[model samples]
Target: MSVTAQCPRPESRALRENHPVMGADWGPFNVIDTAKQDWARGWAALKKFTEREAHARVPYEHKEGAYPLGQWVAEQRRAYGAGQLAGLRARRLEKLGMVWSLADERFQKNLEAAKAYYDQHWTLCAPRTETALDKPVRQWLSNLRRPGALDDHPEWKTAPEAVDKDWNPSWPADWQRHYAALRERVRDEDGPADVLPGFTVHGMDSCRS
Candidate 1:
């Protein structure tokens, strides 16, 4: 049977009230794909990455390569209030050097999980903000790492891939195959498919518990 549940919407007030660094500014990062698949994959990546990174979504307004923290904050303030501002401040806290995951067991586990996915999936680009095409992707990855308050979003636990903005791979590849399989489920029209062909819905079931 198919399942019907509401996807999490932006919780602006919760983010604003909880996050400490409310008015700070952040980056000009990016992620680019060598090619486009169905729109679903790209959208999922964008959502997943943004949620993971904790960056608020902004319209693609600035001309490429000039995603200013000040500009993003100014734009988001009208709706997101201090929550978006907090994301900016948190960006400064990002550690630039190599981080050893083994130092923390829980982090190590998460890193291992991320690495396994990274190894299994096809990531066509390195994700950089120096260029116009890759900026959004880069910022998304940055946010996922330090999601301060946005971590409360339920999608963080369910359909995690939905927010990873940097996700991109060539067509007919394994990741594309995975995406295509899931796309079929979305087409059911009435509700989400309980089991998508060729993909296993693992830990997601545990969420019901």
Candidate 2:
């Protein structure tokens, strides 16, 4: 049985006030995935990397690469802010660099691949500011290593796969078989087999705690 509990929504003001970076400008980081899967995945990867590095939920706008990382740096440097990691020692960029280096080997590989993906797919922002795509891969990786307060977001990024909203999971046949076996219990001695299934019964009690 599920409890119909009324919990706070993601749009709650208390939460929003706590997350000062949520409303930052998306600016000109227009990506080319018309389907938006690339944007979703890239953001997810960025969030995952942040969580693993700091063991907390870091927030940022979905303005592709530059905006989010820069936002993260600013919040982290407060050193005592809610977003900053506990007991943070190194200076902002140095600490960020150490975290970048500490990422799992697989994360590093995926981040590199994401850099290529962005290079090929991302379109230049209108009134194009800089030729970010022209930056070499080494420079791309280096930027993430040591960031400054106003530094542009790092390159070589990736994200988790976007979810398929239209997909629905059907009941498995194995589960149906197990349910049928349990239904057979009605005929054994405890209940009537002819009775229609309903919420009236909770079934045989488990032997284990």
lDDT of each: 0.38, 0.38
lDDT of 1 by residue, 16-116 (tens): 44556542221112234534342234334434445555643433452213434334333434324445333432333222111122123433344344444
Distance from true position, residue 13, model 1, in Å? 54
TM-score of each model, in listed order: 0.18, 0.16
Which stretches in model 2 have alpha-carbon errors above 4 Å?
1-96, 105-109, 115-158, 162-209
Candidate 1 wrong stretches, greater than 4 Å: 1-121, 130-135, 147-149, 156-209
Clash pairs, model 2 backbone: 41-159, 45-159
Clashes of 2: 2
